[model samples]
Structure formats: C-alpha cells, structure tokens
Target chain A: MGKEKRELTGAEIFWECLIREGVEVIFGYPGGYTLPIYDALTKYQDKVRHVLTRHEQGATHMADGFARASGKVGVAMATSGPGATNMITGLATAMMDSSPIVCITGQVPTNVIGTDAFQETDITGATLPVTKHSYLVSDIRDLAHSIREAFYIARTGRPGPVLIDIPKDVQNAKTEFVYPTSPIVLPGYHPPRRATGEQVSRALEMINEAKRPVILAGHGVLISGTANQIRELAEKGNIPVATTLLGIGSIPDQHPLNLGMMGMHGKAQANHAVQNADLLIACGMRFDDRVIGKVSTYSPKSKKIHIDIDAVELNKNIKVDLAINADLAVVLRQIIPGVRVRKHAHWTRKIKEWIKDADRRDILNKKTDVLIGAQVINKIWEGTEGKAVVVSDVGQNQMIEAQYYGHDEPHTHITSGGLGTMGFGLPAAIGTSFAVKDREIWVVVGDGGIQMTISELATAVQENANIKIAIINNGYLGMVRQWQQLFYNARYVETPIYSPDFVKVAEAYRMPGYRVDKIEDIIPTMRKAQAHQGPVLIEFVVEKHDTVYPMVPAGEPLHEMVRRPHVPSDAKEN
Target chain B: MQHTIIALVEDKPGVLNRIVSLFRRRNYNIKSLAVGPCETPGVSRLTIVTDENDSIRQNLVCNNLLKLINVIEVEDVTNVPTVIRENVLIKVQVNAQNREELKNIAKERNARIVDEGERSMILEVTESVGKIQATIDVLRPYGILEIVRSGKIAITRGDDRPEIKNGVAGRGTESSRATEQVNNYLY
Candidate 1:
C-alpha cells in the first residue's frame, strides 16, 4: 500500500484514519486551534457526520453514550485550552464507567507549546490522571500512528477515554500519509487476558463447594458481551445474580435469578442476598466503596473470587481468595465447563423469604397525594413494554429510574455510574438515539440535573432525535434534600432549587410537551410521549420531600440500610 | 523504606508529566526523581525513588507505569545487584592555612577541586551513594558554604539492557508489519 508513497497533510491523514476506524459520527465544537482539521473535514463530510455540540463536555458525553450503546469506539474533538479543558469531566465520567472514547484536542503549535502561547493548554498533562492514555503529537508523521494507537488503546483492556493532542503545526505539516493497518505492538500494555489455569480451577472448586453462591455482576459483563455467558453460568451453578448500577441490563430484570442492582441505592433484596451469601464471585465489577461499603466488614461470610480484565482492579480495594485476570467472556467460558450443575432450592427459598412488603417496597405502590417519580417511570416502563433505552441523570431521579425501569436488553440502561455526573441524561439520550435509531429513547432526569445541560435540547432538536424526556421535576435538588432530611435537622441549605417552566422549555425547542401534576395524568402523558413521532418532554411534578429508601448511606455497610417509613399492616393487600 | 524504580519511556512531550501525574494520583510521594536520555535516541530513562515498603505496592506502581502508552519498560531495581551513583557539587569557605589541608582531604576522597577561589573552593564529586555520603560527611566539618546533589540514578550491574524495539510485538492487529520495510525511513 505504501509503494505509491502518496503525500498528504496531517489534516487529510487524520480524516482518513477516522474513516478507516469506522467513525460515522463525531461530536465536537470547533475552534481556531483545530481549524486545519476542520478545513480538511470538507472533503470527508459525506463519509463522516460531525455533530456540533453546545458544550465540549456534552460532546464527550455524547461520544460516551454512543460507545456505550453501540459497543463501538466513540470520538469527540475540541480546540486548545478551555475547549480541551471542558472535556475533562466527560473524560473522567467515561474513565470511571469504562466507556471507550477517543477525544482529540488541537494544541498550540509546537514552537509555542511550552511558552504558553495564546489558546495553548497542556491537555495531555491535565488529562493524564483521568484518561487511560494520552498522546501529544510533536511530529506530523506520528499523527496517523498516534491516532491508530489511541483507538487501539481506548477500545481494549477495560476500555476508557484516550486523548490525542495535536498541535496546529503538525496538522498542516506535509507527510507521507501512512495509515498503519498493522496492529501496533504495545508490549507493556497487554491486559492479562489468558486466565491463570490454577485460579480458574480454584474458582470452580469454590463455586461447587459453596451452598449459597452469588454473582456480583458489574459493567464488565456488558462491556465484554458476556451477558449470556454469565446467565448460563449462574443457571448451571445455581448462583443468584446481583448487578451494580452500571450492570443494570446485563440480564433481564424479570430473570428468576436476577436480583436487580446491588449498592447504596440498590434494591433491598439484592443487598440482603449479597450480605448473606456464602461465596461471592465478582465478575468485572471492582469492589468500589459505593458498592461495598466498609470494605473490611463487607460480605465477611463470603469467599470472594474476582474476575476482571485489568489486573490493577483485583486486590486494589478488596483482596479475593481467588483472582482471575481475564475478560469476563473468557473467564466465564472456561469456568462454565467445570462448574457443577447444581440447584440450591433452599438458598432460593431463603432469598424469596428475604423479599418483604411488595407494595411498600415498590415506589409505585405508595399512596401519595403528590405525583411520584417512580410511578411515572413505572408507567413509562409499561408504555414501552420495557423496550425503550432509558438514559438517567444523577440524583434521586436516576436511582428511581434504575429501580422502576425494567429492561429486557443489555446496554438499554446508560447512565454515568462511576462519576455520577449530573446533566448527563439529555445529551447521552441524544447519542443513544443515534446509536439505536429505531428504539425509543427516554431521558429520566431530575429538576437539578436537567438545567445543567439544558442547551443540548437544541442539538437534539437539530438532530430530530425521537427521544422522550421525563423530568422528575421536584422543586428541590431531591437527593441532597433527602440527605439533609435524614442527617441534619432538615435545614435545607441551598437544596430547594427552583426550575423554569420545563413544558415551555420543551415547546421552545419546537418539541411536543406535557405537564403531569396529577397522578391520573401520568400514564396519559407517558402515552402521548410514546405515541409522538419526534422528541417530546413531559414534566412530571413529583413530591418535593420524597426520598429513595433502603438507603445505605455512603461508606455504611450494605446490610445497614435505612428502610422506608412504616407500612400499614394490610399494605400487601393494596 | 525508599524504593528506587527505573522506567524507560518514549522521549515525547508530556511523558514526564504523565509519570509525575501517576505518582500523584496513586498517592505515592516522590522523594526524588531524575530523568535523562537512555541509550536509545527516542527513549529516556527515569529514576524515581519513593518511600514505599510492601513489595506488592512497589510491583503495582511498576505495572501501572508500564501501562502508559509511551512507557516501554519499568523495573524496580531497588534490591537488585546494581550500581547507584549520585553527583554532588560542594562549595566550602577556604583560607590560606586550610587550603593544603582541604586538598589533602579531597585527595583522600577521589574528589576534584574544580574551582578554587582564595576565599572559597568548589569541589565536584561523582560516586556511589555510600561514597557520596562519606565525602559529604568529611567535607561538612569545614562549614559547607552550599552543596547541591543530584538524585540517585541506578543501573543493573550487567553488560547492558536489550536494545529498544520500535514496535509492539504483542499488539494483535493485522500481520502487515513487514519485517523488511524500514519503519523509520523517510519518504
């Protein structure tokens, strides 16, 4: 391919490499520093579509959402200095959530890099703590290779964001455009893929020996496309599955063995099962503080076996009895063969006994005068038949959505799990729209998180994304208010925030809208959203003081959850 | 316990910053760090010594350092059979009567009086860590005007480390990395 030795500017080669990498859409806001690449973009517009985001942070989030939904590497770009700096939060969010994203930032010319020229920022340096890997291109010849390597690194081995900072000089410099088709060898960067045979054997033995084995499924199951494998293993080994928040749809919510999300705001039954389990097999999920509160005392009865792609994750937080550093798919395939086909009927019965107060436990069953967030989400779940891709924002609304939304498919629930960034829902839903054009997309956000990224509505309008946004519009920042109510004397310091007329905001975007202050109108508004052909926003005015229950406050033991207010003795009949 | 880690990284902008950032992120306080070009033109060696005990913790740092894209190799040569050297420049106040005496001490220790002023004498010494410590101890009695010492840089006591390979061998991509084709050749 190089015999002809075709000469091209770095700008042209950059576009070529992107096209080769199967990048159909790029989300970014352009600037002077990246003018060369944008100027070269004119020729590649037909092959690659550029989505102009209102904020650089939104661009990164969109890329993250795209990658999360599509299972492909997402790309975001921005210019130097603030333009690059703005992508920091999104990068961190993707890094924590293990989203594969390639962020390209244009830098000041090489001659002026260290001198801090106008619009110059050491983006590579600033993002080193956040990104999986970063590259600063000094020479034009390295541009193609850097991008190729960046993509490879970003998409592989506990995938996370990788940044490529290209100086404007390098973009304009002439070079023989050699887009390396050959895989770049990174000897030091090999993620330990081949599972240690001894570890796998030991894991199998532990699985067979245990009376109550539980699978703590994490985001890795979805990332590695091992949902089926995990389900098969759980069934064969008679292990109950409890997922982390990011592991939402790894298995169907209705699956007999699925115990929903397990964490601070997880279901009571899931947390209870985990706390009581004898053998805990962690698949792709790190025992983060949020999940395993008080690591020293968390699940003390369990013999832990952690299987992850990154070796760094194991023994970093909680040391397991047996550790297998391999892809979830690889580890599961090997272990499934050796796993005994055993049924723990007594354990399943014990788990069922752990489930209490069905009506009181469910958010929808509460007899409340004010419209509730959970009731609205449950109605939407019914309206979409658990088929819509639900992208939730941070706070009370995100937790409520997780609890209420029933998903039948993996990658259906996309939210900022690690960073828990607010304002992630709307733009991310827009990205999910692009990913699965046919599937109905729903953005579940609180009154607080929505306003942070309200500008992305215009981008969604421009894209004509067929998305339905349900704002759980409580007058205050619900989660913070809940915390204040629980811990403090309910001082409500700067917690009760006011919001603009969200229905008007939706109409202003030329989208359809509705307001549901009444409980009876909740299902009607959801029906209208599901029936609408284009983007729609429904403002569901929820109870301001309502709090998410079964609350294991941060750093508290998983079993030490604050249950909901007392229920009537005949509440189960309701 | 202080552990010395040697890392070889691609000589590119922000590589040093990346290494420093990793140390900060991992909450490892850097005691001293010195870096310079290694035998490879495009590669540089970084000598980073940090206060750390557990061998497992040291191994974790090495693994993380090697995980960086530009980082080619990382070796915790703290306990290895190695030569650790440090250079020092000491300036001491001098007088006519003590000039000969100072020279006698300098000769005893293989240190050279690089610059000798009638009022002051500047001495330069490059020695193993132990020797440098001994020299500093011997010279401190004359009331050192000022002394500057470079951080310890270590190398294993062997013929040499292997030559730096240009491309990653384990990267599973296309098999088109033609061995006959010179990778660094200009168009």
Candidate 2:
C-alpha cells in the first residue's frame, strides 16, 4: 500500500489521519509544546471533539477506559516533559491490561530536542518499556503515517498503548500529507488469528477425555468477542468456567457453569475447581502470577491447553501441555464443533458442595452495624439492575466490586487488572460514560485510591459526564492494612491516612454530593444521586477494618485460601 | 551456556534502542552484540551472544525479540551447522626486541599487521571465537596496548534459512487476504 499525497502542515496531517482513522473524541490537555496541534485542532473541531482532562494521567486513563468500554482505539494527547512523564503510570496500566490507546505527546522543537529546552523530555525513550511501540516523529512527512501506524498497532492484535511523540518543529513544518491508502504494513507485527489443525485436534482430544475440565477465561475472551463461543463450549462439554478479574463479565456471573473469579481473593470454589480439574483450558488470559499463585503447584493435576493470540504468552508463564497461539474467538469456533456433548455430573456435584461452603461465608449474608464496602457495591449493583458499567479502582474496593457487583455482561466491568493502579475508577468511569452514553456508569473507588486522582472530579463536571462516583471511605488503604494486620503483626503503618470531606470536595467541583454513614441512607442517597442528570459523588463511610476475604497469600497454591472468618452467632460484633 | 542469535530488523531510527532496551528489561545479559546492514536493503541484521543456559529462557528471549515491532525475524543459530567469525585488532607493545617475534606470531596465527606505530604494532585477526582467544593468548607475552573485536557474525553452512515467522512474507500482496487464508488453514 502507498499513500495519497496532499499538502498540509504536520499538525494538520496529524488531525487528518486521526479523522480518517475514525477518532471521534480525544482526551487531552493542551500546553505550550502542543500549541501547533491544538491550533490545527481548531479547524477540525467539528469532526474531532477534545475533552480537556485535569491531568495528563487522567487523559491516558480515560483513553484506556474509552478503549475498554467501546472496543475502539482511544486517543490521548499531552505536551512534553512533566506532562509526558505523568502519563507513564496510565500508559503502563493500559499496556499491562492490553487496552488499545494511542497517546500523542508534543516534544520540544527538533533542533533543541536534546538541549533540555523548556518542557522537553525524551518521552519516546521514557515510554518505550510501557508502550507496545513508540515513535519520535522527527520528520514532518512521517507525521501522518506515524499517527496511522500508532492507531493500527494500538487497536490490533494483542492491543496495547502506542505512543507518538511529535516535536514542535515537525508539527509546524509544512509537508505533503501522505495518508496511507491501504492497510498499514509491518513485517514484524502479525497477530495470529487461528490455531493449527493438530493443536485444535489435540485440544479437542483433551476436552473430550477429561472428566473435569475447567475453562479459565481471561480478558482475551472479551477482547476477541468470544464470550458466546466460550459459553457454547462450556455448555457442550459441561465444563466449569472460571474467569480472571478482567474476565469477570465474559461469562455471566450467575451462569450455572460459571465458577466466578479465580485467583487470590477469588471465590473459594473457583480456586478449588482449578486445583482439582483434570484439564485446564486457559483461554485468552495469561496465567498471571496472581492468578496462578505458586506456579509450581498451580493446577498440578491439570493437563493444560493454552489458547492466546500472543505467541510469547504461550509458554512464558506456565508450561502448558498444548499451546495454541491464535485468537480466542477463532480457536473457540474451531474447537466447539469438535467438542462432544458430555456430562460431568460428579464434578458438578463436587463444585456445588464447595460453592455451598463459599456461600456460607458470604459477607452479604451477615448483618453488620456499620456500612461496608461490599454492601455498598452490592447495593449499587441492585440499583443499576446489574446493568451499569462499573469502573473499579485498585485494592479492597476493586475486589469488593468484583465479588459483589455481579457483572452479567461483557465490558460492563472495567478495571486496571494487570497493573492494579489506584485512582483509575473516576477517569475510567468518565471515559466509559463518553464511550457508552446511555448506559449508567459507576465509579467504585476507595478513599485512598480516589484521592490519588480526585482532581478528575472536575473533569467529570466539566465534561458533564453522567457518572455516579461511589467512594468506599474506609479511612485506610484497606488492602495493605489487611496484609499488615494478617502478616505484619497488625502494624498499621501509614495505611491510616486522612481525607478531606468528599461531599464538600464534590460540591467544590460544582457537583451534587452526599455522604452515607448508615446502611439505611445508602439506597436513598444512591437513588438521589441516580436521579441527578450530571456527575454525582456519594461517600460511603464503610467499616474501617473490614477485609476482603478468601485471601491467597503470595506464593500460596490456588486451593490454600484463607477463608473469611465465620461469625457464628450474631454478626453485630466486629 | 552461550547462545548466538541473529535478527533481521527494519533499519529505522530507535529500532536498535528498542531491541537493546528489551534485552535490558527482560534481564537477558548480552555477552556481545554486532549489528550491520544485511543483504536486503533497509533491513539491518543483528548478531547477539547471550549467556543463558536454560533452553526455556533462550526461547523466551528469542520470542521477546520478535515481539519488537521493528524486528522482522529472529533465529538462535547456536545448535545449527554454521560458519561463525569474530575479527579482533590487537595493538601489541613491540619496541625493537619483540617486533620480529610478534610478526612470527601473527603469521603463525593467520593474523595481519594492519597498522604499525613507533613502539606498537596492531595485528588484525578474523577467526572463530575460540581461535581468536587462542591468538590473543599467544600474543599476551608482548604487552598488548589495546584490543577491539567485532562481537560475532554467523551464517548457515548450507542453504538452511530461518523460517519467515512474521508478516514479511505477506508484503506486496494483500496482507489481509493472505492473513485470512493463513487463518483459515490454521483454524
């Protein structure tokens, strides 16, 4: 493929490529270095909408959220130096989770690039490890092609962030805009979309022979849009389906065959099933250290059949018996036809018994005097009818939402799964709101995580993003606090951090806010917030020391979970 | 165990940086590296010698190298029947006494006197890694002032070639259609 040449400034060419790539919105913050691009943006304002973010980090995360929610390439823009450095965490988060985002940062003018000029930074070098690929567009003629390539690389294959750092002079330089007319060509980058016949046959053979097969579904299932196929495969073979945190909504949480999330803090039944299953079919998800726990002991009994698009991921983590490096959707389509209808009655009966035990320890079943994070998440789920898009921040709040929110649809639950970045919820929810206009968007964040990027409240207000923010105010970094309490002789350390009154903070941002200390006020306040048309913030002051149970301490095997302590009689006492 | 890997990559700016950074990030220790333009235009070739004994880790490093967007192809030619060479230039302190002895050593080791200084003579040697070490060992009796060695370069002895594992083979043709056909066959 060649280019269609036309005369335009590099900045204008950037916008032209973006417009042709179908970018409707760009989450960005303008600065001195990026003035030329912002200036060019004025001419294309109608075609491309720009949402000014509170910080460059927010912009990156919003772009990430937009990509995850919309399944499209999300774009974020920032200037050089500090602005570019600030987006590192967000870019790393997106990269870790395989979210498709293109971040454009303005560099100093080419002549002074290495002189340490005002607001100049080596952003391409800085982001090289975090980004899937990065470019320093020094030449004006390469501007359009770089932007196109960035978009293509970001959205295709194992999707991740791709950064394009354009120098100021390059943006101002006049050149013939050579827009790529055909599909961009990259010799090194080929995303495999199918499995080999031998691999598929071997996988089918394993699937047919195993009495207890467990499908460990990951974010790949959702990314490849193979949830239906996964469900079909599970039903045809009566295989139990377990999901990673990012894979939560791929299989409906309530499906009979669904074993829920599997990992540390995952359901006890899911963990046990993985440990006991004869055949472990890992689909679209890497066996993260967190998911696999002690790798040597992880799924020790299972003969593994691994399917993923990324070839590097095949034997990188757990050495599987059969590795099928291909797209999950295509692989599932091929294998589902060969899988015979079978029954695993004994395995199902065993899992049902384990589920009963896990349900007995369910925190929601107990009555507590004070509010809890789990209850707040469960109530939000109820209020939204389990239909709202929930963006969760890291730590206990994220786990609580994953456990209690009960996501029933794919893309409904968006979180920074691999990186576990705090302060992701609000901006991500805002991005989700932009991606999905009609669906109710919710931010489930902890007080600690929310404070990390609390400034995004203003972004939500300015964008008029109809997102309901739920701050699980536990007055501590609950996840760390739990670890300290359990493993560090209860030394609280700096976990007990203070926070400003969130309601007043929300009000300062010119958005309606409410604080709920009692369980009774939770639903009412939530209802009031939902009734509001714009962004609304609700602070739920939960029990300070409540922990996320079913904890599999680091290096422990999947089945060796520290179950939630059973409050035998009255649940009133702490 | 030392492994020799060769890669063909797009000769674009920062491509070398990406490859080197990937090695650093992955903690794969590179014992020696040499990069130059290959027979193909606009495609650079890299020969890297990494000290990794684990076969799994070696495979991982090769896979990670291929993950780089500029890297077109990668192959570990350690176990293959191949011709490998390293060129070394050693400047040995000669003076009047040891000059003839140095010349005799260079001739015996198939080395050449590339440069001669007032008091030191530079001998260039192109040989296998072990032979180069042997030549250097023989010249150690004369005080060596400086040494520069091309890391490594390797090629197959016969017509054996590394498989085209990436999308380079689909170039010029409609890659989308080619990919679809490949997908159909694989699926």
Candidate 3:
C-alpha cells in the first residue's frame, strides 16, 4: 500500500504524538501564543480531555498529582512568560519526587524572538534546573520527534519532568509528519542496566559475610517495581530493612523484617539499627542530608554499598564501598539468586529485642485525653484500612504521616519532599481525586500550610471532588516551632499562626466542615467527613507544643537521639 | 589546576546574569569567559577558563552550568590541545616618518589595516595572546590611541569536534546520525 506523507504543523504533530503516547488528559490554560495548540486540541477532543485550570500553578500541580497517583506521565500546557514561570515550582517538586510529567509551553513567534515582543519569555531557560530535559521547537518538523522524546525522557530513567516550548510561528508552520512507534534512541541518556556478575557476586559475599547487615530501601525500590524482589531477598537472607521517608512503602510496614523509617523523626529502633549496623546495603536511595545527619558520623562503623539508577548520585554524597549503577528491579532480580539463604538468628533476635523494648515505651498507650497529630493520622489510616490516597503538606504533619501511616501500595502517599512546598496538599488532593475519582482521597495539612492555598477549596467544590481534608491545627507551624524550641532556646518567635473559622470558609464554598477537639471524637469526625456527599474539611486541634519523638539533632547520628525530650518523672523511670 | 570549559546554552535574556550569579553563588573562580553566537540558531557557545580542580570544575559543569535550563552541554577542554584567539582593534597615532615602520611591523604580524585617518591608523590583529601582545608592544612606539580586545575564543586541535561532543549535530556519533540528518534538513 502506497501512502503519501502530508505536511503537518507543529501543533498538529504535538496533538498526534500525545494521542500516540496514550495521553488521555491535559491540564492547561490558553494564551495568545498558545492559541494554535489549543485549536489543534479542540479538533481532537475525543482523543484527549483538556482541563481548564484557574491558574498555571494549579494546572501544573494537577499534572503532578495525576502523575504521582497513576504512575503515568502527566501532561500540562501553558503559555510563555508568567505562565511558564509559574510552573517552575511544580516542575521542581515533580523532579524531586521523581514523578513523570511533561509541561508544554508556547513561545514567541520565530521572527520576533529576542525582540521583547508581547507575551514572550524563554520558557526553556527558566526551567533548566527543574526539568529532566527541555526542547525549544524553532522548526515545525522537529515537533513530533521532540514530543516523542519528551515523553520518553519524562517517563524513563529516574522519571522526572520534561518541557517542550514551541514558537507561535512554528506551531502554524507545516511539514511532513511521521509519528514514531518505537522507542527513541538518545545518546548518553541510557539508564544503567542490572549490576554486572562481579558486582552481584561481591554484594552477595558482603551480605553473607556480615554479622549485622541492614537494608536501607528508598523510593527507587518502589519506582523500579522491585519491592517484591527486595522482600524475597530480605526474607530469605533474614536481613532487617530500614526505609527512608520516600521509601516508606517499599516493603509493607507489617513485615517482621521492616525496621520502619530512619533518621530524624524515625523509629527509635530503626535509627539505632542504622547507626550500629556493620554493613548497610543502601538500595535505590540518594543519601540526602536529612537521612545522613552529621555525614562524617553517620554509619561510622558500617560499610555502605550504594545501588542507584543514576550514576551521578553513586558517590556524590556519602562514600560507598561498592557503587553499582543499575535499575533496582533489574539489580534485585539478579542479586536475589546469588544471595545465600542463610538465617542470621543473632541479628534477627537483636532487632526483635529492640522492637519489644520500643513497644513497652509506646507513646500511643499513654491514655492521653488530648488528641495528638500522630494519633489522628493513625486513626485515619486505621479507618481507611490503609486504602486511602494520603496527600500531606510540609512540616510536622508530613513527618508524622511519614512515620505513622501504613502504606500498603506504591504512590499511595504523595508529598512534596525535596522542595517541601507548603501549599502542596490541597491542590494535590484535588488533582488526585480527579485521577482516581472513586477512591477515597485525603489531604492531611497543618493549619499554617493549609492557609497558604486554601482557596483551592473552590476548585474541589466546582469539580465535585469528594476529597476529605484533615487539618492538623496546632496553632503554629509545628515543625518550625519544634526546631526553635530545641535549637533557638524555646523562643517561639513568629511560628504562631492565627486562622479564621475553617467551618465558615468551607461553608462559604458550599462544603461540609467539622472541628474535633477531644481525642475520643477524632474517629467519629473522620467518619462523618468521609460520609459527606462532596468535599469535606475536618480541623483537629492538636497539642500546641507536642514534639515528634526520637529526633536526631540537626547534625547528630541517627542512634544518638534525644528520645522525645522526656519529662523529669519519665526520665527517672528510665 | 587551570581548566577550560566549553558550554552550549540557549541564547535567552538574563542567561549571562544567571551564569554570573551561579559562579558567584557557587564560589567558582572564573579567570576568563567568552560568549558568541553558534552555528545553530537560538543556541550560543561559551568558553570559560577557571582555576578550580577537576572535581570542582566538574561540579560547576554538571551541577551549576547544566542546571541552567538554557545550558544544554558542558565540556572540559583542559586536557585537549587547542588554539585560542582574540581580535583587538587598536587606533594608533602615526606620522609619515613612523608610518612605514608601523606598516612593516603590521605586515610582519599579518595584522590588517582597517582604517586610516589623518591623525591615527587603526590596525586589527587576530592571533594568540603572545603574538597579539608582541604586536601591541611593537605598535606602542607609534602612540596607542584606542585599544579594544574581544574575549578569547578557543577551538580544539585536530579532528576532535566539540559540537558533536556537546550533542550538537554535524559530527554526531553513528547512532545520532539520523538526528543529525533531521536537524540538518530542518535548519
């Protein structure tokens, strides 16, 4: 069959490529230069559903939420200048969390570029640090290839955001278009494969030889779909696994070998194990500053073996005894067989003893009448049966959720980690609700953080998203207050936050709201909020000065923790 | 250790400011820098020399320069043999008595006589720093009027193509030849 290739504009090619990539939805707002792409999108309404956002920032966060929830490349479109600049924060957030997103923007016309024309800005230049890669389409013919490449780059190899800026003239200019069906080949962009045989053998030898070995799992394990493999290896070898904050769900928390989280605000036993281990098999995690407090002192006695997908991150921070650059799943698949099925009865017994000792000092068993943030989050987790998509805002509430919430699924808990953007949860929840409308979506935010982007409530009302908003109101920025208390000699300073009646605000948006002050009313209030027809906001007044326990001071090793600043009487008991 | 780094960045507004800010923020010591238009539209080439060690230089290349959305490629040319040149146009005061001597010196150095007014003569010299300095020394006798020198631009010797290494087309590797062809056709 003879088929003639016809000329197509960049805008047309972009739509076609997006359809080919199975992009069913796009969130964006149109402007002067982006009108052509919008026109093309109009022609393909059946193939793609475009969500018009109130602002560019909302659109980007929506894309981010979609990506985080569905594990697919989220797409957003915006015009140049302020439209593109507003997307930088969202893009950076996605980049940090390793979410796949593609941000498309319009550029000034080809002829008037650099002339300071109306609605012109170098969108590509502004997003360099935040994106995995970027392309500026000056020619129409390159649009199809660029879009395909953008999708590939965004979805593969340490998944992150990629941007493509198309000039107005190029969008209208026509060329022969060919949609690529196969994977695009990019030089110098190959993601590392499984570890070599020598590396696996060396790793196995270390695992078998060590008397005390711990697995430090990170988000890379979950991203690579190696959680089951990791579990199998850990179970077979009787290795205790400690997870980073982002790696919370890499292994089920209920698993006996799981040591919970490590570092500041981590479980006491988990941090202790990390500090005292003889060998740390760090899998799929970059040792961020938070994880390795006082870098020189962290793991002073342990030999660290780091495995990561990005080669650049292998030795960028803490030195590794063995650095293997490979996909976690591939590496795990290969290493699991080589590992000898040996039982470290001594190591398992020691960890179990520590866990038992920790259980005796269980903070939840104190029978406190006052509701706490941790208790509230734990109740929500229990009520939802660990099935809800939990979106957390930054600060103490985010840390508490990371510590206490039991995540049984991948991408279940969405939070802004690296950037730690405060106003991330509400919009992110709204976005998550859209991605999986039938599932129960909950936004857990602090009073201070919620006030930043509370206006997005109107978006929930408009979209009819039945999202449950849980405000852990502590009357201050709890995390900052805790830091000030410890580091700043308890001088509260400007951490205090005063807010209006959240019920009134929710009512103003025609949504239901509730306030829970007593510890006994927490579960019932959450139940009522969940039972509400549309979006519901529940405010919980937590203890004003309560601190998250087992905190490693700013530059202290994980095991050398303050133990929750115990009262004098409790200290006497110890 | 002195090192020369070549980078390709999108030619956009405030790029220079961002580059300067990055250097200042990262505390990287920059000895010299040159920026100019490249063969591809919308992209410019920058050559910078610094005295930082290899690791620090690599950090500057990967973490700082490459972090800039506009910057597409960064390469270290410290170990590569290269030719560096700059153009300087100097207007000198000369009379009939010393004109012949100055002209002879200029001819010897292959400098071009751009303009000659009644009071002064302007000579354009394109050469290495040492040769340019020698020519300037020779012309100092004729009384230098105005001197303006462009920043040093460098290219590696032999057939090592920096553009291809930087992921630009023309001399890309075998796998990238298709992209090169497409890029060529588009441009």
Give the clash count for each candidate. 1, 0, 1
Mark the regions of model 2 whose C-alpha exceeds 4 Å error after superposition. A1-5, A570-574, B167-187
For model 3, residues A75-155, the per-residue Cα lDDT tens digits are: 989998889888888898888878788999998999998898988887776776678878888878778878888887787
Best-to-worst order by DockQ is: 2, 1, 3
Model 3: residues >4 Å from true position, as ranges? A1-12, A108-119, A167-177, A180-185, A353-357, A437-439, A532-534, A565-574, B5-27, B33-48, B54-187
Q: Write the per-residue lDDT of candidate 2 for residues A1-574, one digit (tens) a residue.
A: 6667778988898999888888899999998889999999989999999999999999999999999999988889999999899999999999999999999999999989889899888999988999999999989877877887787788777889999999989989998776767656787777776776777888889999999899999999998888888999999999999999999888997899999999998999999999999999999999998898998999888899998877778788899998877778778888899999998999999999999888777788788889978888888988899999999999999999999998888999999999999998989888888889878999999999999999999999998999999999999999999999999999999999899989899999999999998888888888899899999999999999998989999989889999987656655443
The DockQ scores of all candidates, in the order shown, are 0.21, 0.34, 0.09
lDDT of 1 by residue, A263-290 (tens): 8988888888888888999999988888
Docking class of 1: incorrect
lDDT of 3 at A358: 68
- Minimal lDDT window, size 10, model 1 chain A: A356-365
Off by over 4 Å in 1: A1-4, A114-116, A357-360, B39-41, B53-59, B78-83, B107-131, B156-187
| lDDT (Cα atoms) of all candidates against the true structure | 0.84, 0.88, 0.80
Error of model 2, residue B162, in angstroms: 3.5
User: Ranking under lDDT, best-scoring first?
Assistant: 2, 1, 3
- Candidate 1 vs candidate 3: the TM-score winner is 1
